[model samples]
Target: MKTALRTTTKTGTFAQALEDFKQITKVGLAVSVVFSSVAGYFLGAETIDYKVLLLLMIGGYFMVGASNAYNQIIERDLDALMKRTMNRPVPSGRMSVNTAFIIATVCAVLGIVILYMVNPKTAMFGAISIFLYTSVYTPLKTKTPLSVFVGAFPGAIPFMLGWVAATNTFGIEPGTLFMIQFFWQFPHFWAIGWLLYDDYKKAGYYMLPTGKKDSATALQVIMYTIWMIIVSVFPVTGLTGRLHLSVTGAVIVALLGVGMLYFAIRLYHEKDNAAARKLMLASVAYITFVQIVYVADKFIGGY
Candidate 1:
C-alpha cells in the first residue's frame, strides 16, 4: 500500500508540474509563433528541407517558451495583482522562481543550440528575441505604452527568422514578411488590450497607445488594420521579391483583410469589450488565413 501510494503521488506531482509548465510557457502562443516561422521558412526556401523545418519549429517553440518563462519570473509580482494573471504558475505558487528560471535557462540554451545547428544567424536572432522579450518588453509594460511597439519587434522576428534560416541572408523578401507581421501586431495586440484593459490597468500595464479605451486608441487600431490590409496584398503585385501570389490568392487574402477590417471598424464604433473581443478573434483569423493563402498560392502556382 505504501509503495502504490507513493507512485500515485509522484504521478500527480509530475502531472501538475507539466500543467504549470504549460501555463508558464503559454503553449498556444508558442505554437502560433512556430507556425509563423514555418510559414516564413516555406516562403523563403528554394527547396524545402524537412530537417531544417523541424529544427526551426522546435527551436522557435522552445525559445519563445523560454522568453515566456522569464517574463513570468520578472512579472510575478505584477501578475499577482491581475485577476487574469494571478493563477499563473509563479504568481500562484505552483512553481518557484528558481524552478522557472532553471526551465528558462535550459530552454534558452537548448533552443539556441538547436537553432545554431541550423545557422549562426538563426541562433543570433533567436538569442536576440529572448533578450528583447524578457529584458525590454517585460519591464516596459508598466512604464510606457510604447512597450507594445517594443514587444512587436521580437514578435515580428519569428516570421522573418524563418526566411533567414532558409536563405541564410537578409533581404527584401524577409523584410516584407517582417513588415507584414510587424504591422499586424498593432491591431492584434490592441484588440487584446482593449479586451483586457481593466485587468491590464489593475497591473499598471497601459498597452494601448492612448493609455485608455478612447477614440484615439480605437482609431489607431483601425488605421493599423488598414495598413495591415494594404501590406498583405503587396505580394500579389509581383513587387515583393520572390514572394508572389496569383490573382485568385490575392483576392482571397483581400477578402480576409476585409473581414478583419469590418471588426476593426465595429470596435471603433462600439469601443467596448464585446467589439474588441470580436476584433481580436477576427485578427487571428485574418493572419492565419493570409499565411495559409500565401503558402497555398505558391503550391498551386508552382512558384
Candidate 2:
C-alpha cells in the first residue's frame, strides 16, 4: 500500500511539472511563432539548409519561451488579479520567480548562441525580439492603449526573422512580410481584447485602442483588417521582388481577408463579446490560412 501511494504521488508530481512548464512557456503560442518563422525561411531560402532550419526551430522556440517567461514574471501580480491568468505557474505559486528568471536567462543565452551559429544577424534580431517583448510590451500593457502598437514590433518580427535567417538581409521582400504581420496584429489583438475586456480590466490592461467597447474601437478594427488584407495582396503584384504572389494566390488571400472582414464587420454591428469571440476565431483562421497560402503559392504558383 505504501509503495503504491508513493508511485502515484511521483507520477502526479511529474505530470504537474509538465503542465507547469507548458503554462509557463505557453507552448501552443510558441509553436505558432516557430511555424511562422519556418514559413518565412522556406519562402526566402534558395535552397533549404536543413541544419540551419533545425537550429532556427530550436533557437526560435527557446527565445520565444524566454520572452513568455519574462512576461509572466513582470505580470505575476497582475496575472493573479485576472481570473484567466490567476492559475498560471508564477501567479499560482507553482513556479518561483527565481526559477523563472533562471529559465529565461538560460533560454536566452542558449537561444542566442544557437542562432549565432546560424549567423550574427539572426542572433542579433533574436536578442532584440526578446528585449522588446519583455521590456516594452509587457509594461506598456497597463500604461496606454498604444501598447498594442509597441507589441506589434516584436510580434511582426518572426516572419521577417525567418526571411532574414534564410537570406541574411533585411530587404523589400521581408519588409512586405513584416508589414502584413504588423497590420494583421491590430485586428487579431483587438478582438482578443474585446473578448477579454472585463478580465483585462481587472488587471488594468488597456489592450484595446479606446479602452471602451464602442463604435470607434470597432471601426478601427475594421479599418486595420482592410489594411492587413491590402498588404497581404501586395506580394502578388510582383513589386516585392523575390516575394511574388501568383493570380490564384491573390484570390485565396482575398478570400481569407474577406472572411476576417466579415467577422470584423459583425463585431462592429454587435459590439459584444459574442461578436468579438467570432472575430477572434476568424482572425486566427485568417492569419494561419493566409500564411499557409503564402508559402503554398511559392511552390504551386511559382511567382
Candidate 3:
C-alpha cells in the first residue's frame, strides 16, 4: 500500500507538471503557428524534405513557446487582474517567475540552435521573432493601441520563415507570404480585442485601434480585412515569383474573404460581443483556409 501510494503521487505530480507546461507555453497557439510554418514550407519547396520539415516544426514550437512563456512572466501581475488570464500558471501561483524564466531561456536557446541546423537565416529570423515578441510586443501591450501592429511583425514571421527554411533564401515569394499574414493579423486580433475589451481593460491592455469597441475600430477591422483579401489574390497576377495562384484559387480565396468580411460587417452593425466573437472565429477560419488554398493551388492546381 505504501509503494502504491508513492507511485500514484509521483504520477499525479508529473501530470500536474505537464499541465503547467502546456498552460505556460500555450500549446494550441504554438501548434497553430507551426501549422502556418509547415504550410509555407510546402508552398516554397520544389521537393519535399522531411528532415528539414521536422526541424521546422520542433524549432518553431520552441520559439513560440519561449515567447509566450516570457510574455506571461512579464505580464503576470496584469494577467492576475484579468479573469481570462488569472488562471494561467504564473498568475495563479502554480509556477514561479524564476522557473518560467528558466523554461523560456532554455526554449529560446534550443529553438535557435535547432533552427540554425536548417539554415543560418532561419535561426536569425527565429531570434528576431523572439526578440520582437518578448522584448518589443509584450511591453507595448499596455502602452499603446499600436502594439497590435507591432505584434503583427513577429506573428507574420513564421509563415515566411518556412519559405526561408525551405529555400534558404528570402525573396519575393517569402516577402509576399509575410505580407499576407501580416495584413491578416489586424482583423484577426482586433476582433479578439473587441470581444475581450472588458477583460483587457482590467489588465490595462490597449488592443483595439480606436482604444474602444466602437464603429471606428470596426471600420479599421474592415479596412484591414479588405487589404488582406486583396493581397491574398495578388499572386494570381503571376507577379509574386514562384508563389503564383491559379484563377480558381484566387476566386476561392476571394470567396473566403467575403465570408470573413460579412462577419466584420455584422460586428460593425451589431456592436455586441456575440458579433465580435463570430468575427474572431471567422478571421481564424479565413486565415487557415487561405493558407490551405494557397498551398493546394501550388501543388494540385499547378499554379
Candidate 4:
C-alpha cells in the first residue's frame, strides 16, 4: 500500500506540472508568436536579423505565458465552476496559487528583458500586451461583453510585435498587420464564444456580443468575418505602400478569404454547434495560412 501510494503521488505531481505548463503557454499564444515572426521576416526589413527574431519568439513566449498564468490564477475558482476548465492546474488543486504567481512574475521579467534587448519599442509593446491582457481584459471578461474588444488589443499585438522587432519602429506595415489580426479576432473569438457559451456562462464569462447564442450574435460573427476578409485583402491594393500585395498574391489571399467567408456564412445560417466548431477551425486555419501566404508571396513572387 505504501509503494502504491507513493507511485500515485509521483504520477499526480508529474501531471500537475504538465498542466501548469499548458496553462502558462496557451496554444493560441504560441501560434501568435509563430505567425508574427513570419510576418516580421516578410516585412522585408532593411536587414534580417535572426538574433532579433529569436529574441522576439522567446520574449513573446514569456509575455504570453505570464499573462495566461495570471489569468488562471485570477480565474481559479471560476475555472473550477466550468466543466471545460475544471481540470486546469490551479482550479483542480494540482498547483498552488503562490507557485503560479511566482512563475508568472519570472516569465514576465524574462520576456521583457529579451524584448528590451531586441528593441525598446518591442519591449514596450510586450509589456503593454501583458498589462492589457492581465490587468484589463482578464477581469473585464466577467463584467462586460466589451471585454472581447479590449482583449483584442493585446491579442493582436503579436503580428505588430514582429514588425517592431525587425524594424525597431512602428510603421505602415505593422499598422496594416495589426488591423488584419485585430479584425479577424472578433469573428474568431465570437465563434468560440458561441461554441463555449454554456461553459463560459457557468464561469460568468460574457464572451459574446449579446451574451447569448442567438441570431444576433451569429450576425455579428458574420459581419466581423466579412470585415476580416476585407482587411486581409487590403494589403493587395498597394494602398498601404510598403505592405502592398502583388496582384497574383492578392488573388490567392482573396481565395483564402472566400474560404473563411464560406465558414462564416455557414455559421450565420446554421448557428449549430457543428457549424460553430467548423468556423472556429477554419478561422484558425485562415489566419495561419493567410500569414504564411503573405510571407511566401514576398519570397516566391507568387505563382
**Best of the candidates, TM-score:** 3
For 177-294, candidate 4 gives per-residue lDDT tens digits of 8888898899899889999988898888989999888889888888888788788888877777677677777888889888888988888788788999988899888888888888
TM-score of each: 0.98, 0.98, 0.99, 0.92
lDDT of 1 by residue, 17-82 (tens): 999989998999999999999999988899989999999999998999999999999999999999
Off by over 4 Å in 1: none
- Candidate 3, residue 210: the lDDT equals 90
Residue range 1-303, candidate 3, lDDT tens digits: 999999999999999999999989899999999999999999989899999999999999999999999999999999999999999999999999999999999999999999999999999999999999999999999999999999999999999999999999999999999999999999999989999999999989989999998999999999999999999899999898888899999999999999999999998999999999999999999989999998988889864
Whole-model Cα lDDT of every candidate shown, in order = 0.92, 0.92, 0.94, 0.84
Indicate the TM-score of model 3: 0.99
On residues 34-109, what C-alpha lDDT tens digit does candidate 2 reach at each position?
A: 9989999999998999999999999999989999999999999999999999999999999899998998899899
Residue-pair clashes per candidate:
0, 0, 0, 0
Residue 209: error of model 2 in Å? 0.7
CA lDDT of 298 in candidate 1? 88
lDDT value for candidate 2? 0.92
Model 4 residue runs over 4 Å out of place are 1-16
Top lDDT: which candidate number? 3
For model 3, which pairs clash?
none
